[model samples]
Target: MTLSFFDQFMSPVFMGIPLILLALSLPWILLPNPTLRWLSNRFLALQNSAIGNATQQLFSPINPNGHNWAILLIPLLLFLITLNMLGILPYTFTPTTQLSINLAIATPLWLATVILGMRKQPTIALSHILPMGTPNLLIPILIIIETISLFVRPVALAVRMTANLTAGHLLMQLIATAGFVLMSNMPVIALNICIVLFLLSLLEMAVAMIQAYVFVLLLTLYLQENV
Candidate 1:
């Protein structure tokens, strides 16, 4: 079916995200795993047992919400896909690639780690972070430096993703838009540019997946550090 330029733009926002999310998550959804299976059986066992029986599995054999992470994926995956597609849409920028949005997501994640660390070990947290190996005089200065470095994690994460996505997107736009602009006067040059744009689009698909993986990996590392 024929689609207007506006429709093409909206297609990524509306259709592309849902489809891509579903495709990427099918492995987790469809694949049978021990976690879900054990929970399912526990669920059935509870229904069959009496009121006195230990059926409520909040912090025991089963989690409060069995396969809840899987459920959460439905939204997280959707959001990520939508963000990726946002840049692909015409006359629009990817919010995910914006420093503000990236910092919004990253800052909280890092802060959560710090808070948890503090809660787990009130005095030890500071000593553990700063350590006893350093000189006494340097303690205050080191802490100040370390504190700034810790907070800079989100800023780094935000800039890294935003810059990468923006650079790649600008490259794509330059090729595609420039090709279209040249079509009137320089037919041969326009044709060559179109080929370059086509290649760039294909490369972009790979980049989209790489960026998603990198983001998730960084998230995991941050969680591990604090938790």
Candidate 2:
């Protein structure tokens, strides 16, 4: 059997069970569970420190009402970061690379923000449909455009994530394949390619982490507008 370049994105199965479930759940189990000891492990301390700093930077601008979303945002940020980093390992599938999964996650959260705004401040929410001091003729056009843009937020989020990961994964695969094929015939070039591949892998790791933070950060921004 031959392997397709895109096959990496597909969910694998073993003994009739999809491994996507494992991919989704494995990250949570790997996280450090709190213990009853007075002094925590250094790793746990580092983790807590990182979380605290991230939360401060992310939620500092929002009012107290929006601060309550830390529970939702922090876990999600960690989950995405783990999933993305895991996918970097050999033979692992990234759930975020799938648009359906991303849309499933992004749409409801985005809709919730909109709903919160409408529920908490209907005037402010409705007012978003049109800016103040608009010309009579432009009001309808502005409203239509804004309304369409409002609906497209989730799609934009899903596509941004899907595209970034998909493109990076594909590119990395292409480079690795070229290196493998050229190893015997063009060893010098292949050696250089290997060095490049190592560098690119490091960059991809950073991209993976940054994209996850950006995803949660955008959600927090949406929540801020609402709360």
Candidate 3:
């Protein structure tokens, strides 16, 4: 029974084929396509406006060279948020809950920023390892520490998303199970649990949106340092 609670995190299979592919593609299918008309429908217009605003805010602090990344980053932001929101629905899988997927998404992007810094400004990039002023004895130790911190950034990014989603899902599942159990023996307690579950669902929805934004925002900050 305990294992059943964790089964939700596993990728579902049908006739031996994993349905994760379908889960990933589902969001794109729900999006509205552009038409030939000069004026878009309300849905498209609202989407365009939101994307425009997000792009403006994301790129404002970045250098002109970094602006080229908007094409990649903006789509990633949308994809993550869509997946997160969809996961909140019943009978849906949350890909971001998987550490492998999150790491795959984060590591390459983080590495790209690091590589860009190395290629464009090798001295400045390496200089980040050492402080402006340090005791001669501490220089080596500081470099090692900073290097470890640098490498840990992507790991932290992946873990942060995974941990937050996993915790919320587990808590929701526990509360829901309790509500069901109490419904048979204690009507009043079950009602209270239902109310708490409703509030928690709302909080989880907010978390879904906020986590996606934070992931993109941190990537932007990393790019800002490089470019």
Candidate 4:
């Protein structure tokens, strides 16, 4: 039975039960736990140091009041990165490729930031709806445009990630399928295709990490505007 290229994005199941929960929880389990020792193992220490740097950079632009969310957003970044990288392995499903999952993750966090901004500085938050010195006739038009953009942030976040990952996976599958089909009749060409596939795999790995960073970074910028 031939499967469609999009089949890879399908959520997996066993015995008619969804395995998405297991997939979502696996990243946490794969991460190393913090230990009480004065010095951690080299790998764990490196991990901690890297995460610390990311946390500091992410919070630097935001008002200190917003730093409280570092705890939530940092772990979220790690979770997404882990999920994305893990999905690169054979037979693994990428949850982030699903628009529903991405939207669910993004929308609430985005709304929370908006609410926080409005709560802390109502006047300032409302001011973002329209720019200064606008023509009398243009006021309503600008307000309508700004309102639509404001509400579209989360949807943009969801679609950006989903589209990037889905396209990468689709291209990789197409390349691999072509390479395998050509292997018997055109060995040299198939070998060249394999080399190209290998390079594309590396590019996908980088894309996976970068997309995760961009996802969180955009959220941080949104929080910055609010705080």
Candidate 5:
């Protein structure tokens, strides 16, 4: 029974091909393309406005040179939010819930920022490893610690998103199962559980949006440091 709960996390396969690719592609397919008309529909206008505001806030701390990243970062924020929200729907798979997928997305972008720093200002980038006026005996230890922390950023990003989504999904499943089992013997209790479940679902929806923003926000912070 416990294993059955975990089965939802597994990548579905059909005719020997994993459907993860399909799941990843599904979000973009649902987005409405901007029309050539002078005016856009309310939904498109709102989406554009939100993207602009978020991009402005995200890049505010970054240097002018970093403005170029808006092209990549804005789309990424939308993609993540869409995927997270879609996952909450019944029978839908969330690509971000997989640790490997999240890590794959995070590590390359994080590494790119690190590489940009090294390429643009190697001395400044390397200087982050050791602070000024350190005791000679502690110098080596501090460098090692800082280096480990630097590499751990991407791992933390991946784990944070994966763990949050996984925990929420598990809790929802547990509550749903209890509600189902209680319905026949105790309809009143089952109805209460359903109410709780409904509220919890609303909370999870908020979490889905917040986690996506948090993920993007952290990436922008990292970029700010590097740029």
Candidate 6:
């Protein structure tokens, strides 16, 4: 068969390990937020104030010595990788391939973009959304178009990821299903089809990572623009 069935279960678990490792490593290697520190202690019943202090020092994002947005990198990468793994697994679904999950990911990034924009230039945040200058006669039309596009950021993000994963996965499924249907009596032809499907699965893996990277890259670029 194309994947030996076991590969379906193994892929997501294998993919998830790096993500979990990244999450676990965050406390030791990154700087802490006092709010998160306190929350972690309270939730986990951590009693050692010295340890807490040490943990906080290690994990604090606001710390002078820590990398800016470094802590966030863990979750951001994990989320996308998890999404990709989800797409690869059989029977187990890829929620990221759905608009809902994409929206969940995209909306927050878009909000962060807005919040950062407002923080940097509150007075002109909304107005500065469009390019600096334009003809007076076209200003209103341009603003309307810009505003519409701004509102569609989440939609665009959602569609991009969902469509990519869905298309790739469906192509694989359809190809494999076709092989099975055509080669019900011919073992050799069936085997060849399985090989094609296996190759397609590999292609799907690449596509999954690419789509996730694109979404995250776009989010980063939007944030950079506002900053």
| lDDT per residue as tens, model 1, 69-105 | 2333233433554466556655554566556667877
Which pairs of residues have clashing backbones in candidate 6? Answer: 30-58, 30-59, 31-59, 31-60, 32-59, 32-60
lDDT (tens digit, per residue) of candidate 6 on 1-227: 47542233222445446333343343343333345443465523443463345335434533333234445644565457555765566656565665765797789878887787778767666765556668788888998998888889889988998878777777787778778887868888888989999898888888876776677667665665565
| Candidate 2 wrongly placed segments (more than 4 Å) | none
TM-score of each: 0.60, 0.97, 0.95, 0.98, 0.96, 0.66
How many clashing residue pairs are found in candidate 2?
0
Ranking under TM-score, best-scoring first? Answer: 4, 2, 5, 3, 6, 1
The pairs that clash in candidate 4 are none
Error of 3 at 226 (Å): 0.6
Worst 10 residues of 4 by lDDT: 122-131
Stretches off by above 4 angstroms in model 5 are 1-3
Give lDDT per model, in order: 0.59, 0.92, 0.92, 0.94, 0.90, 0.64
Write candidate 3's Cα lDDT for 94-211 as tens digits.
9989999999999999999999999998888888899788899999899999999999999999999999998998899999999999999999999999999999999999998889
lDDT score of residue 143 within candidate 2: 93
For model 3, the superposed segments whose C-alpha errors exceed 4 Å read none
Give the per-residue lDDT of model 2 (tens digit) for 140-187: 899999999999999998999989999999989999999999999999
Best by lDDT: 4
Query: How accurate locally is residue 181 in candidate 4, as Cα lDDT from 0 to 100?
Result: 100
RMSD of each: 11.2, 1.1, 1.4, 0.9, 1.4, 11.1
For model 2, where is the 10-residue window of minimal lDDT?
218-227
Using TM-score as the measure, which candidate wins? Answer: 4
For residues 72-169, could you state the per-residue lDDT of candidate 5 as single tens digits?
98888889989888888889888899999999989999999999999898888888899889999999999999999999999999999999998998
Clashes of each: 0, 0, 0, 0, 0, 6
Give a tens-digit lDDT track for model 4, residues 147-173: 999999999999999999999999999
Candidate 5: residue 194 lDDT (0-100):
100
